[model samples]
Target: MRGAHSTADTAVQAPPHWLRTLALLLICAAYLQGGLVKLFDFGGAVAEMQHFGIAPAEPAAIAVIALELVAPAMIVLGVWRWLAALALAAFTLAATLMANRYWDAPPEARFMLMNAFYEHLGLCGAFLLIVWEDLRARRARRDRAMLAGTKGSALQ
Candidate 1:
C-alpha cells in the first residue's frame, strides 16, 4: 500500500550531525579559501578579473570575491542552501567558460587547460547536486509537515 508503515523506514540511521557539517565544510573549503585570498589580495583579484576580460575589473573582482565567500558559507550553514548552491553552480559554469578556453590553447597548453576546464565543470556539477539535495530535503520536510496535519504519517 502507498501509505503502509514499516519498521525498516523508522530504523534507517542518518549520519551524525557533526559528520554532515564537516562534509559540507570540506566541500566549501576551496571556495572559502579562494574568497579569503582574493579579499586579502585585491590587486591580484583585479588582475585575474582583467585577465578574464571582465570589464571594470575592480567591481568584477569584488563581486566575484563576495560570491565566492557568501555562497559557500551559506551552503555550509544550510541557509538558503539551494539558492546558494545554484548561484555557485552558475558562476562556476560562467567562469569556466570564460577562463578555460582549452579549445583555443596551443598544443603544449591544451592538455593542462582542458583538465582545468573539466575540473571546473565537475565543481559546477557538484554544486548543482548540492542544490538538488537541498531542494529534495526541503520538499521532504514540507511533505512531512503536511502529513503530520492529516492521517498520512505512514512511510512510503
Candidate 2:
C-alpha cells in the first residue's frame, strides 16, 4: 500500500525572486530610516554612540549611514548580495557586542541592542537560504557528472 504522504515531509522550494525582492525591500527600508534618523539627529546619536563605546561618533555614524544606504541597494538589486549580507552581519555583531558589554544599563537601553541583534538574526537566516540554494545547484551538477562518468565506464 502507498503510505500517506505529509506536506511537511516534502522539501520546501526556494523563495521566488519576487518574494526575495519584497523581503529585501522591507529590510532595506527599515535600515534606511534608521540611518536617516541618526543622521538628522547627530548630536543625540553621537551621545548614544559614545555611551556604547563607539568613539569618534561622527565617523561611526557616517559608516552606519553608508552601510545602510548602499547595502540595501546592493541586496535589492541582487548585485553583490552576499557581500552586502556579510557587511550587515558584521555591523549587527558589533551592535550586539556593544549591547552585551553594557548589560548593566537601563532596560530600555538594553532593549535597543536586543532589537538590533534580532534583526541581524533574521538577515543571517536569509543569507543562509541564499547560500543553500547556491550549494544545492552545485551538488546537482556534480551528481549529474558522476552519473555520466559511471554510464561511460560501464560501456567500456
Candidate 3:
C-alpha cells in the first residue's frame, strides 16, 4: 500500500474555480456598493469631495465613482485585471492618505482614523498581490507555450 492513494490526498486537490470567483466577488462587493451609492447620490458624493478639499468637486466625484465601478468589475471579470488592480490600489492609497490623515485628527478621533488608514494599506497590499499573481500566471503560460513550440519544431 506504499503507493496507494489516501482520502486525505484526494481531499488535498486544488479548490474549484468557483471558489476563486466567490472570493473575487466578496473582495469587490465594497467597491461595487460604494460606486452604486455614489451613482445614486451624486450630489452627496460631490459634497463629500468638497469636504475633502478636492477641487472641482463634482468632476472628482464623478471620476471616483466611475473608477470604483469599472475597476472592480474588470478585476472580477479577469478582463485587464492587472490594470484594474493597479488602478484600485492607487486609488485606495490616495484615498487613505487624504481621508485618513490620522495625525491631523483630534485625539479622540485619531485612533479610528489610524485604523482606517491601516485597513486601506492592507487593501492596497492585496491589490498588489493580485497584480503579481496575474503577471506570474501570464509568464508561466508564455513559457509553457514557448517550450511546447520548441519541442514541436525539434520533432519536425
Candidates' lDDT values, in order?
Answer: 0.89, 0.73, 0.91
Please, what's the RMSD in Å of model 1?
4.8
Write down the RMSD of all candidates, one decimal each.
4.8, 5.2, 3.4
Clashes of 3: 0
Q: Residues 119-155, candidate 3, lDDT per residue (tens digit)?
A: 8898899899889978887899899999999999999
- Following a full C-alpha superposition, what root-mean-square deviation does model 3 have from the true structure? 3.4
Which 10 residues in a row give candidate 1 its minimum summed lDDT? Answer: 147-156
What are the per-residue Cα lDDT tens digits for candidate 2 across 1-156?
A: 368668876778768989978977886677778778887887877877788778788788788888877887787887767677667766766666666544665877877766666766776676556545546666797999999999999999
Tell me the lDDT of candidate 1.
0.89
lDDT of 3 at 8: 93
What lDDT is reached at residue 37 by model 1?
97
Q: After superposition, how far is residue 66 of candidate 1 from its true place, in Å?
A: 0.7
Worst 10 residues of 2 by lDDT: 127-136
Q: Write the per-residue lDDT of candidate 1 for residues 1-156, one digit (tens) a residue.
A: 788879987686867989978887877887899999999999999999888878999999999899989998898889999999899889888888888899998899999989999998988888888889899999999998987867654643
